[model samples]
Target: MFSQSVRSFTKQALQWSRIKLVHQRITLTKFTTLFFYLALFNCIILIALQTVAFVDNEDATEIITGFLNQANVTQDHIIYISNNELLKCKDLPSLSDANCETWLQEDDGDDDNDSNDSKSRRSLGGFFSARSVSVPRHHSENAKTEKYSNGTISGLELDNGKVLDTSCIQSLIWLNDVIHDSMAEDVVTLVFQIWLFFLSLATILNESLPHLGAAIAGHVLVTAWAGYRIRNTHKLREHYQELIVHQVCEGVDFLGAWWDVRTDHTIPILVFNVIAFVLATYLATRLYRVYARETFNRVRASPRLHKIYKLVLVLSVCVQLSGFFTVAATAMWLDKASTGSINRVAKHLVLYRAVFSTMAVLEIPWAILGWICIRSENRRQFWIFAGISVLLLASSSAIFASPLYQFIFQTWPFFASMTIVSYLLILVITVLGVWSRTQFGKGLPEFLKEEEKLEGADFAPVYIPDLKDRKSFDSEKGHGSDIDTEPIASLPPLLASQPLHKPPPAEKRYRTSSVYSDINRDTVKLSSTPPLAQAILSEQSPVSDCPPTPNRSNFETASRSPLSRTPGDRSERSRNSLPGNPRPINIQESSSGRPGRTGLIRI
Candidate 1:
């Protein structure tokens, strides 16, 4: 009767266990599928953004071509073209030998009624009309006919038979071509695409691998790519500066006319890349420590250090993003030169330059300070520091977005795009700020947390004892079996059946080396040397015919019969006459480094 009752209870327990196992399997499968779909979508978005950035190169090239057309070097817009020897057209010495066709075209009605205001507006507007016109007859013929035997046009012969040097025009054209090609090969676009691809690959890798080393490597590569981008942009900025100076030296007042020389995009690109490279470097450090299996406490000073690091990053991002808006503000302010004071424009320009220069110059030292603060014992102090810093930053933004500067967004298409990008960056930074707060460590991105979870799920195995070796102490006690004859290995079912009782206080901290106990293996050999198991055994009372006090040494020597075995094992084993196995207990330290036995089962 006792055995029959035990078997019935065990059968019901087994049925419930099977149901829970199925449910858990379904849950895990759903999670995996969700990640797979998300990764695919992420890849698509990244590829599209890269394609758009690449297409922007063509737009840049078109802007340059449009600027050159507006210069109208072939037209009688002599005011727009510099009269320097490098660029100026030569005048006819005298019309003695010149035919009517040899004389420059002139129309009395064209200049008669045009006011200075209209001329200035026309110069500011398209300066050159958008129509296909042949190059001037005098200059075009000389340019083509003066070609050397090497097929290179050395110079164009003027109407007076003197040559106008081609070197300056050729150099400017070459620089334009080089800038266009550089834009096409933008490192940001290429790096971002590659980074996203590796990130996508990480999601797939999580399905089978135990670590996200590939994704970590991608971040390191991106940091280097960002540095490369900054170098290229710096070189480009130098070229633009040189061109502006050249134009100024030749008395060309239209220095601001060329979009290539005065881009609202480059400043933003430069600032953002600097910030990103710094952040990526920090990110790589975080990932490397994890990959190397280092403890968090050893890597970082305290919980506060992480918050401080994040705060610093947030500040840098916000400051650099403001530089984008400054560019727009400068453009719009300069556009109102007819109505607004040049002093006001110059003041805003100097202020923006000062702000940008300050941030760029201090970025490295600020990062160094953040690194130093990571070792700080106090965590809450950074919050106070960060709050004050943010308030100052906000004040700076407000200054840039003041009523005086709002006209830029209203005046130029460049500022309009800058306005949109500014808003988008705001949204992005806000989301990142919120997400950073939820992280467990300093400089750890959300993606790394997800990767860690995936890795744990893939590698951490749950141990389940075999049902055949399962023994029920309650059934044995009722069946009049000899309790003394039961092995120590069979005590789990008895301990599991006992009513919940308060565990005794620890005598001392017991530290034991941990090992991976594979669930698929034939046996999990638990060492009785652990004081934790001893404490548990000491709590149990002896029954009739059982030892009054169980000897711990006896359990140490007796080989524990494995409760579970892999299905592939061919060795036959005795089956339990009655019900389910006791739940498996696990004791391992968590990531945060809390020590001692955990997850001991009651049933």
Candidate 2:
């Protein structure tokens, strides 16, 4: 009786342990579900935009002074320029009389040379000076002037103009001497404070209209023919839309001097994030297949590719830093026609921004890679970090910063554009993730070995279906948050269902993976597929070769009801798997916690 009681107690403990483990797992999953994507949804709109109406005429006056200085410096200097022109008056030859600078002809004799010298001396009466050149100005506001680089004003006029700081881009162009006429200046001439009043009215009206119409429409659509399904799908669509709106509408939606910080220092820091985003999304994405997927497996075992990956990592960091420089450029150049003192200050803003945020955006990929390396048990921790990293990047880029916000706040124009770029950034991140996953899935014998070991196990009971030919895994049914088709559907009673021996407890938790080892280091031979052909990616892998998963009894069962596939766990395994021409996987999963992983793998 004692022995029997001990056995019963042991059985109950084991069962209780499993239940507790499951409960803990469920709680962790729910926590991750609540936090990870919630943060992602919140981050879509944290852009700062506030309009500062420039009341000072000093900045405008300074711009005019610089132009006048430039005109004065170049006016008297005779220019024989087409492709290039002398930047400083001193660089030009001193004019002599009616005939300016002329190349000396040695054979023309000393008399002609002397005559030429005299002509040159005559023209050099007013040796290049700041007072030489002038800018042409009309008598009044309506004066029409054409062909302005050579035009100059004899007298100085300091006109004070007011503009929204958001109008900085147009202002920059005007200052750069890009716009040659007063007509271009007229755009900023109108009083815009009245528009603010109208804007307030519109905001009120927009608020007054209770979105009940939209809400009712959503309910009616959900209730019509397919209530459960329509409601779910409709809700999903609405949620996605709300997510976007939330991103776009984050923070104090006021654009009045909110960007004064850009005018001060944080400009280049912002620019760095922009650059990282652009290169990671635009440049890195282009070669991601070659670097991450194509060459990754080949270099998995080679120290050379590791160095290359490190190089890529370094380059990515550099590009992020480069983004800071781009912002620095913005800071310096985002001003109106200003003098060297102002431009110099702008450049300092760039450098300052760089030093500040170098680590923030630079660590984005490292955070992503960390999540990639996490074991499933600890996945939630890593994913939280991943979400944080992505959010940091989004905030850094100002993806939610809109031009309208800038219009109100009078700041850098690109800040608003930067908000929109978050979409591209997310897409790029998705691409990088897919490429990484795909590379991981395809290459390294170790990865294959893990899949094989899992396949051989009776406890987990995973089926290795032929996935190389399909677009993606078709079975999204699973016990996890990943949104993949045919993902793991939890453990089945495989040992009881069939007369198969379960592996010893010691062997169950782990297996040796040689994915990174024992590859032919000779010239690689690529797998043959048409230039454009579809292929499936599987997280399900095998050891060197997984022993056939099919039960021997499957063939001999007497009453085989046509071997119909089960509704759940009824999919066909690969009938005849092909030899792998292994490459690295490149896939990016989402934090959305949908039915499956986003599986952002590419061809």
Candidate 3:
């Protein structure tokens, strides 16, 4: 009784353990699918946030001014530029001739270059400096309002008698210049982060779940924080937009000036995010479905291909790292070595280098994972990167050699396009994963042999199909045929004497095959008809060893059913047969070709 009770307890424990294992597996599968979806969702949110964070002119202006101030542009310079009236002077040369730059020009040399420099400096100074002068008190409300209590006018009155602060116009232009510069940096930063996000997804596709999942989770968390910041930034931008619209609708005093300088940084961000969100959502849905179905299990990549993939990835990482350092060192050198155009070029070089470097660093992990997940379509992304790298390297080298490299290179547009292209490329790559072939081709690595040996017993039961039982079943169903068991009497004497080809060696046969080999063979059927012609024709020599020729009539007679042809039809056979200089004829037929087995021809 005690033994029976213990047995019952053991069986129940075994059943519970099996149930727990199945539940754990199902839970793991769900989590895997969930993480993939989360990764994609994070990317989408980040994109949206990036669009909002960087797409406000007001905020951009603030950042630019702050950056310029940090770069050592003085408060006086900012104030002068902010209120400059250079735009009112249509003819710059005339403006310079009329305005003597009393404060800015040194008047030290008589050289033409010195004179030109003086004129340019004076014109710029004049635009920012208003000709303030002491004025007598006026009774008129407007005149009184314009004059300070100290009896001084604050601004220059134009020929049209309009007082305007042109200094502010200069400030606006300066802000616009810096805004453009900072915008590039913003784009680079966002694009770099985006590159990292997709790269994490790529890793998830290729790496072991536990390791990759932890890495991806950490990355997504960082991205999520960035997204949070972006969302807040969006709110600020929206509030600013509201303020701008409110001021415009109210026809504020500076409405005309503000409208003239209005920058629509909003549209591009909106458009980019809208499109990106849609694409990301679709791709995420597909990715979710892929993981849910455990479709990645079907993908079988060769060990040699994996090695090649890793090598390519390593090469890419090396190239990216090299490019980053090269561009960075060059930019820093140029910044110290020269100014003006060179300075601008150096600034752009540094920004783009930083972007590329950040992306490269993030790409290393993904490239490592690519060994497992790299598909034919993803190959194009790498090829495109290589092409872009070559083009940029050549262009950068050429630009560096040129005297006016900065002015000629126009790095912003080019680098911006490249960043956009990178984003689009990754997006396409992510989407293509859904269509990518997942079935692993047959092959076992050397290490797998040891594993197979250890687990061989466990696998035997699955592969040990009952061939005898299958044959019996086939016979009972009347599907079994004598095609594979046919006698050699039906074959020609020459063909029958030829030995069958030996099968391939075991090692060579199993080199790239699965552990459980499923052998299959093609079945061919042969039906004999009555003899169409005699061995020798009537017209042939009696002792001739050559066989008789089969004419058109013999072919027709052969086409008929075996039952249709009579064994005693000697007259028909004689008529069909022809005197021959023929050797033995061998017939080969395939089901895919000519009907009724008319493949016979004399050699």
Candidate 4:
């Protein structure tokens, strides 16, 4: 009685433990699901904010242009100043004819008449002296302006009747170029953000480790980029403010105001970026923990296969990272090369951008395909991915060898370095992809499939047929009652005359059926048994030849031998069978419709 009570308590304890484990699993899953969606919501908000910021930056060009027009500045005036190198007029012979020293002498002579007028005149004189250029009166139509680099400039006039010098015109030109470049960068950043949003969505929905890693890496890269842009913009603002302080250009104040507005717009974006980065980091950490648990389980299940899976997973993540960098590098190159003043020998800028962008986007699909091929061991996908990788490799090489390389390098050395890094990463990814393909049929795929099955087992439903009306059900099907049914074949006379044997222990009877039925049957076929026992086994009809047992439940029928005739025993036994009685001989039918022994009947 004490043993029985102890056993009952132990069973209840085990049941409670199982329940607690299940509850923990469910709670963890719910927690992760909630946080995943929260992160996605944050991403959606970021996308909307970024889109607004992009549109605002894009419209800044028109705003700057309108401001320049209001200030009586034309595109031609800025271009003429840039092309003519008018800012260094002191070095020009034509501008040297008007003596800047005469204006300074005149301003100094009037210092006592009116101090305010003298200060303004002195400032004007000092501006000219700083550039070492003459104060120009209106240029007569007959005046010959020296040709500088590309265009010949006569003079620039502001609405205030003040002749604009090179410093003022150059500031306006710089402002226009900065706005244009900012617009281009906005476009690039917008596109990348869109890509990142979809990548994040996929990672959340698929719960894939590789996609999670890629999304995390993307967030970090974009955050760093945002910080860089903010810092650079601040520096440009300071530089323009210095120009305003020195009163170098008449329009420097307008440019400074525009910079202030641009900075205000960018501050919000940076705030959103930092918030998104934090969310991404949190989500990635949780995902990695879950991934580690699953990985640990897989390793315990199959170490060799897990090793291969680990390698493939690492390589797949690297491929994904490479693809992302490739896109980023291409975008940077496009941004720089497109905004450059220098003309490229390869005039198909649009075509080049399209081709490189397409190739960069294709890297993502290639990485996904490589992962699929490795997991599924699909040779067709393997070959397709390999072929695409090779083509991309060739295209990348051609790009390096093309004139675009020099254009990009000349435009921005940073872009050139990023491109080189992207190329090397791609090379590494391609090599790893080919290597991963070789790991096909190495049991990793099967192991993963089995793991999925085991994880899903808790949700699988069980069906138990009703057995209360079994006799009527069997009768309606034109089958005799199972209880009244006679044996289809009689035992051999020699074995029938032998004494009945005591049944095997209850524990042996309760053991679950082995999956290796064929191996058991083969063992029965080769075993040496007494002639009488063998005769009795041979005389019993095959399981398929007998009518179905309607009285027994499906679970009981599956657990016990079909030949058991008594309620007290679940398997038939022969007395004096080999020493130390083993399991009863199960006379089941083979797939070939022959009677076969599946259990050993040792004495």
Candidate 5:
């Protein structure tokens, strides 16, 4: 009864073990499907939000252009003011004479007429028609001469004896440029998001750890970019508000109204950014979990080089991520410094942009090559990767020593810090990559391939014949014993019940070349022998039925018993007993009517 219960328990355990593997496979499939759908939804929503942002940017540009036109502000006027340092009425020498009051009165009348005309035109024109107004050309050369001499200057004196400051005009121009840049950034981001969406789909289809890692890197980049844009927008708004509070201008009310409209449009984008960031973070975490689990499995398969391989992968990801952020920050810094008061040569800026952009763009391909090299243990690819790393390191170092280094530190300290961090990370990756190159081709790739095959086999479907069909088939094959009729799940327990004193039939024995072949063959042999052999061998020997298991043993036994002789030995003995030159023996028919040969087979 106890043995029967053990058999039942073992059968149930085998069934449950198979069920567990199926359940895990099903769960993973469901998870990947859900992730793919969620990512698609995210991509759709981002597209809508970016579309709205693009429209808002267009509207803001039109509004700014309309306001500039109504104020009669031309690019030439702005350039003239900037070049002459004409900031206020006190800075204008033409506004300090007794005729200034008369000029102010005339200017006020002319401004009233211009305002009336602008209002009529605006009323007649459509929404974007504000930009359609042809700006009157300004005589910057004449203005320059009038500023130094005593020539009368037009539009210098305003109502209340105040002159328009360049600060307000500069702020408006800056804001317009910011909006345009935001629009461009939106387009770029939209493209990147689309690329990421497809990458995610590929990741789901292939379930590749490296692909998942790349997706996570993309998510991090998008999230950081969104945050940076948000911060920059907030700074722009604050600067505009500060200008309105400190300076008195005729367009202040218009600016406030336009700003309110712009803010309303911006709020939706902010909400979208928040949602995108949340989704990105969630997806990144999920992908990271998957990546880490797969990486763990691969590492476990090849533990000899696991430490170095894992470190290389980790450093490669870090390098890619840092490289992306560094490029972004450097671009932002370039934009800010190029528009700032600092005097930088154009050639230097172009060089800086080119170098950083190239490095950033190469990061992805470099990481891919590194992964391939590591997996395939390709020495040539590793050398190429190492050489590129050295070049990038040297180039980065050269950039640090360039003239713009101080400019970056002073103008954009964040960029400077990111550069430093990225440089250090690159250095580490280079060193670790070279070290890992030496440890390649040591059976790690083969181990990983074996692991993949095992996983695939676990998920593969198995067909089990019905019990009645199996029994019929066994009977037809002349193997219809009770052992052959048992279900597969119960066969292991029944085989385990065989007595240990009996050895397996020599015809069924075979050798294996695997490292663990001895253990595996011994286990299979012990479980496959007939139970009756135990009783017969024990009764003849007068020893216990079960013997202690040995660590290692050969299947071939030389006990001189008929059952113990191998097939080859038996055949050779028959040939020798056939009335030959060296040896001969007699064969006779037994009572069972079967010809029997009696002889000892010697090895």
Candidate 6:
């Protein structure tokens, strides 16, 4: 709710700001797509980390359950723990088999000893083990004493009074005291720590490092492509003609343009789904970039920090992965030694849940970075996105840290369900790059944006080639005469009246408006009309001047009369009325039309 409220307030502020926004480049290459892929990949990683976390929680749960059932802690004393009920006999009220030694054998070596101990069987639960018991002395060299119990001949006990006729203990315990310490999670933690250290290095080498290289190369490649695309973007959309303007008393609330991804009725759902999902995801992240930039700038991070950050990030991942694998190894070890009968159902739940819950804890940091990276365009969108991010992270955390998550897998006899979620999450996240590619660490646009935004206030241009009278430069030159007419095409052609060779250097220099304004004025808005049009508008009254291209002079002569028209492009204005190509403008009407200007201008 707090997040949502933030979103609402932020949205209002952003919406207002957007209205005031003058212009922004609408090109795609300025964006680093690696960040988008990273966002996707980060989610995938979270899913994976969540799985490992679940497994770890299982380990914790098993250990906790074991402790609950344990009779002792130190190796000095034996603690017999089981997953299920290990001993049961309803017939004998005072009898119990908590201890495991000295059960009666079928044939007693000494008949006299059997006679003395015969009453003991009736009092005890049939063939019972006395943990602190005396075994009948046997002459046979073959028989061995049971280690867990006292001097007893181990034998199965059958409860005769019950209809089931069952031997009570029904659980499995594989490793005894001899190997429990060796196979425990703490030991596994160390081993997996080693395993994960290497595994993460491998991940870094194969997945991260390669991807980073690909992205670096991709940056150069994409930038080149964008430059190429812009050089020849003459093909305007065909639908631009359909831009029927509507007059609104209050102006428009929203401007939306829709494109049909699938115009045909028979597009395959699989292909459509793929395309739509990708496009939507891209648009969302692109919109997100604006917001993400603000945060990256706030953090004051940079790609230059990648080397150290990568080392640290990899190390953190190594620690986390080690913790994860340790949980898995411990669970597998416990499952083998589990005794279902001795331990209650509640105990199994506890044992498995605790171990796996720990796995979720380690993924929290990655999730945070992801949230920080999945930006929205403005405060409003950012707030909303933040809320969603929080929800995704919290859900994963719940699955990782909560008991409900353990129950999800514990109910299954095998870990098939849990494993699926685990595998999918890992695969998707690694590929997706943690909800945002840039969020993972470095070499990304998120880093780039920060680099751009956080430059020192004491910035100095490389060189200040002092110029003269920019406002005068602006006033004197018409469209053909202005040096900045084709800014992207480089400096405008040499002035017509200026000498072809160097005539002489000027003595004085002056700054136009301010040094900064003149130097960095790419984003400033000029008048909507072209300089040539401005010349026509001021030089000639609204009564004259249409263009004359090729043989369309007669048709345009009538069109230029401004009989009932407004000041719009002649070509655009002629669009709706004419049958053939719209008549070209007739340039013969004005006082200093092309004849007079071209006559005077010569470099």
Strongest candidate by TM-score: 4
**Candidate 2: lDDT over CA atoms?**
0.30
Error of 2 at 195 (Å): 44
- Which candidate ranks first by lDDT, i.e. highest? 4
Report the C-alpha lDDT of model 5 over 1-603, residue by residue, as the tens digit: 999999999999999987775454334544565567666877887778777777877777776665454444544211111111212221112222312111111112244558644543443343234323332322122221112255333232232344445444444554555565566566656766776677677666555555566666676556665666666665555444433322333424223344444555556655655665566557556555544555464335546567755665676555545445445545655564455222222236667767767776776667567667766778888888787788778877787566455544533434554566567767877887877777776776776676567557636322233465555433332344455443454657877677445545655443223223334544311122345544443333221112222232322221222232222345544543343212221111133455333222121
User: Candidate 3: lDDT of 261?
Assistant: 24
State the lDDT of candidate 4 residue by residue for 1-603, as single tens digits.
999999999999999987775444433454345545655666677667667666666665565455444344443321212211222221111232322121111123343668745544555556434433222222222222332376644334534454545445444554565556566566656666777766665565445677777777777767777788778776555444334323454432442244455667788778888887887687578667655555455335567676777777777776766666677777776665565232222356777788788887787788778768877888998898888788778888887655555534533433554567677767876887777777777777777677666555666222221366445434332344545233323557787677677767755543323324334332222223345555455555433212332222332332433432211122333332324433443433344455434332222
User: lDDT by residue for model 2 over 153-234, one digit each (tens)?
Assistant: 3322323221112111111222223212111111221111122223222212222111212222212221231223223323
List where candidate 6 sits over 4 angstroms from the true fold: 1-178, 184-194, 206-326, 329-333, 336-602
Model 3, 1-603: lDDT tens per residue?
Answer: 999999999999999987775454333334334545555665676566556545554454554344333233332221111111211211111223323231111233455666545644553355223112222221112311133588544433333354433232223333344344444445644554565455545444442222333233334333343344345334332322222211211211222222212223333444444444444444344344433222222333466644443333343333323322333333333332243222332335555545445445444443333333333334555445444444444444444443333332333333333333343333333333322323223232322334334333433212211455446434332345434445566678998888765655544432212112323422222245345533322222222122233344444444443312222245433432433212222222223345333222322
TM-score of 2: 0.21
Worst 10 residues of 4 by lDDT: 98-107
Span of 10 residues, lowest total lDDT, candidate 3 = 78-87
RMSD of each: 23.6, 31.2, 25.4, 20.0, 18.1, 28.0
Candidate 2 or 6, higher lDDT? Answer: 6
Provide backbone clash counts, one per model: 2, 85, 15, 4, 0, 59
Using lDDT as the measure, name the better of candidate 3 and candidate 6.
3
Which runs in model 3 stand beyond 4 Å of their true positions? Answer: 1-38, 58-164, 184-197, 206-310, 316-392, 402-603
Which lDDT values do the candidates have, in the order given? Answer: 0.38, 0.30, 0.37, 0.55, 0.51, 0.31
Residue 245's C-alpha lDDT in candidate 5? 22
- lDDT of residue 400 for candidate 1: 53
Report the lDDT tens digits of candidate 6 across residue range 506-577. 332221122123444333211122345544543432322332222234223423422222334565444423
Please give the distance, in angstroms, between residue 430's alpha carbon in candidate 2 and its true position after superposition: 5.4
**Candidate 2 residue 467 C-alpha distance from true site, Å:** 27
